[model samples]
Target chain A: MNRMRIGDLTERAGVTQRTVRYYESIGLLPSGEREGNGHHYYTEETVARLQKIDQLKKVGLSLEEIRDVIELYFTDTSEVLPKRKVLGILYRHLADTDQKLEALGQFRSDLQSNIERFERWLEANERD
Target chain B: MNRMRIGDLTERAGVTQRTVRYYESIGLLPSGEREGNGHHYYTEETVARLQKIDQLKKVGLSLEEIRDVIELYFTDTSEVLPKRKVLGILYRHLADTDQKLEALGQFRSDLQSNIERFERWLEANERD
Candidate 1:
């Protein structure tokens, strides 16, 4: 079984060492075994876990929500039920993202109009 | 000239007093005149500024970016040029929001697939 240091894990995970430590501190990542020199050694499974965290973070999952999902992943409950719950959360998040997108679209439109109005004002002033 | 109290502004703006103060502290809002009791009284123009802030916040503008936009609004520069710059920033924000939406869509699809796979696994295990 291959083990990796904290720096190695962070490099492989494509996240900063501080982020990895923060995840561990916040219990997003499980604590690794410590060596005699106080260095933490993580198993290969840590890479997969970090990848999942990265994916969830990319999807805008809050750290708290990601922690809940990670807990569900580790729990002994019926896998189907937990996954269904996670899917429900994902659907809700999708709805939120859609709403945000709509809001951004509106903002973009408003900004465009403001720009055009300003252009007219400048043109009118320039003729004066 | 009509003036509004801090409480009134917060209520009308649909943001907390703390958020209003924080915005002011971050210079997103201009400092208002103080009454005899040291209470800040805002003019009607404040409402429009607050509304703009609310709209920008809805579109997920960071406080720093929002401050820049607000500053541009007040600057004596050519209105057309400033507005054009703001529009550019809005366009970039729209692109970012679109990307985030795409990522969320992918996450939702992945979660749905995970749920279905888990269901199949449960069914298979139950039959054994």
Candidate 2:
């Protein structure tokens, strides 16, 4: 298996080096290992995790929220009881997403109305 | 009409005093007047403007973006050509809003799937 450094992981993930470092600094990402020359290195899993983080960010999840979601995947699932914390995070995110959708929908509707009003005004003036 | 202080404007707009000052500093809002006592005061129109700014922000427009939108209202509309800058801002925001809606929809779908998977695992364990 090829060992990936920060540059390789960032290139493959299409994220900036600064963003990768910032994620690690914020504890959203793990700092993998140090090479012989003292340079940091990452595994393929880190690349995948970076991609996941980017996807979550596009969906408007905060870093803290993404951290909680990531915790769900690493949790041991073979146990009898499911992770209650994961469930709580998911429920909260769902409610938040719903509110965002509602706000965006209304914003879109208002935009359409304003555009129509502009068109009407233009037409009324054009007839003169 | 009576003049308004920053406190009165913030209270009417449901925004923080810090936010009002920040907006003024960023030029999204105008700093109104100095009284005999050297304290700042805002007009009724400023109160209305603050409310408009707050409404635009709720719909996800950045301060810079909101500034462009506000310019549309102030522009003289009697002229034949419409304000191109305002139109550009609105069109760009519309496209951005559509993209956000798409991403949010996808995120909601993924979240629902994860919740269902977790529930299924929980039920399977209960049956054992």
Candidate 3:
């Protein structure tokens, strides 16, 4: 469907209602259009915006930075964006993503060790 | 030093004073012990606890969920932990971390594609 309610939008975007409301309040997302029945309805574009926001967040862009660049994603053309500026944002995001990946990899290793240690300790100390 | 003031603790832990205070208020961290100086003091263990909380948060564990399993990391020995329960929590965290890794990988891929598209468009549209 081209139009949906907040519940459907959130379900489709994989974000919470609070997130949608917060984004709308902060101007990162447009407020849903009110229909003739007095119910607010969001379009598929809203779902895409929410998903884009989520993706940006995963790369550690602050909401302010996301606000600055989000329109480029949905806007009519890339010619409007300054050449170097857009590339700068992309490069920074790539760097941020790499750092996160490294950190998460380290964390996963640590978690695994802790798990193994617990298993060994349980085997030694816990009686069946 | 075994004991440090809150300022030092926050700096060492790379967390904000607000985070330290909130953790203390929520019983997620021990309130710093007070001495004759009237200023509260935290220990190295407190720093480690803050770090553990951060790691757990990065893997998407809620504060409540973190509380349920945090002590296992700091407690004296593994015997006190119920064998199956601790294993279950560790397994769940591992699964959560894996899911996060996958999502981040997807985000990274999408970002790369967007960057390439912008680059190509800029090359075609902008000239010196």
Candidate 4:
């Protein structure tokens, strides 16, 4: 198993070292091994975990929610029941994302209408 | 010329008093009148300004950019040329909003694809 220092892990994961430490502090990430020189070392699995964290954040999961998802990923993989349970969680997340997209669409329309109002003001001012 | 205290202004504008004070501290809003006991009093204009700030925030304008817009609203209305200049600024903001909507649309698609992947995994696991 290839191991990496904290710096290397942060660089490979495209997250700041401070963010990685914060995640660990919040229990969103696992603690790493301490070397003889007091440096931390992590396995390649840390990289994969960080990537998953980034993906979950992009999908709008809070750290607490991501922790829940991570727990689901690790617990009881010997049966199909866990996968079915995960499907239900994912479906709820899907609905949340859809709601977010709907809100964004509404904001976009508001911006358009405001722009039109400003344009009309400009046009009327130009005539005066 | 009806005057209101900070609390009244915030209540009418649907923002917290702290937010109104922060806007004043940041120079995005003018400082209010100070009473004999040192309480701040504001006019109805503060209410309109807070509403404008809220609308600009919804459209994703930074405080600095919103300050610029506010300046444009206040400055040099004697000529149509200033209105034209403001139109240019608003056009740039329109482009930025469009870009944000595009990125949000992309994220929505990614969420949909992830949901499909989870559904497939659930189906495969159920068969086993």
Question: Which candidate should be chosen as best, given lDDT against the real structure?
Answer: 3
Instruction: Candidate 3: list runs displaced more than 4 Å.
Output: A3-22, A31-43, A51-69, B16-18, B33-39, B55-62
Could you tell me every candidate's TM-score relative to the true structure? Answer: 0.67, 0.79, 0.75, 0.57
| Per-candidate DockQ vs. reference | 0.39, 0.50, 0.47, 0.28
Clashes of each: 0, 0, 0, 0
Which one is best on DockQ? 2
Write the residue-wise lDDT of candidate 2 on B1-128 in tens digits. Answer: 46878788778778899988898898887777886887788877777787767666666677888877764544454463454444556677788889888988988987897788787776776755
Which run of 10 residues does model 2 chain A get worst, by summed lDDT? A73-82
Docking model 2 quality class: medium
In model 4, the runs with Cα more than 4 Å from the true position are: A33-45, A48-103, A106-128, B1-3, B32-45, B55-103, B106-128
Share of reference contacts found in each model = 0.43, 0.46, 0.54, 0.43
Among all windows of 10 consecutive residues in model 3 chain A, the one with the lowest summed lDDT is A75-84
Model 4, position A14, has a per-residue lDDT of 95
Q: By the TM-score metric, which is better: model 1 or model 4?
A: 1
- lDDT (tens digit, per residue) of candidate 1 on A9-102: 8888788888888988999998889978898998778888888887777666679988866654455546335555655765665576667657
User: lDDT by residue for model 4 over A1-128, one digit each (tens)?
Assistant: 47988889998999999999999999998889886888888988888889878766655567988886665444453454455676677677667666666655665565566568667776776756
Docking outcome class, model 1: acceptable
For candidate 3, what is the lDDT?
0.82
Candidate 1 vs 4: which has more DockQ: 1
> Chain B alone, model 4: TM-score?
0.66
Instruction: Name the better of 1 and 2 by DockQ.
Output: 2
Error of 4 at A36 (Å): 7.8
Candidate 1 chain A: minimum summed lDDT over ten consecutive residues — where? Answer: A72-81
Quantify all predictions' global Cα lDDT against the true fold.
Answer: 0.72, 0.76, 0.82, 0.73
Worst 10 residues of 4 chain A by lDDT: A72-81
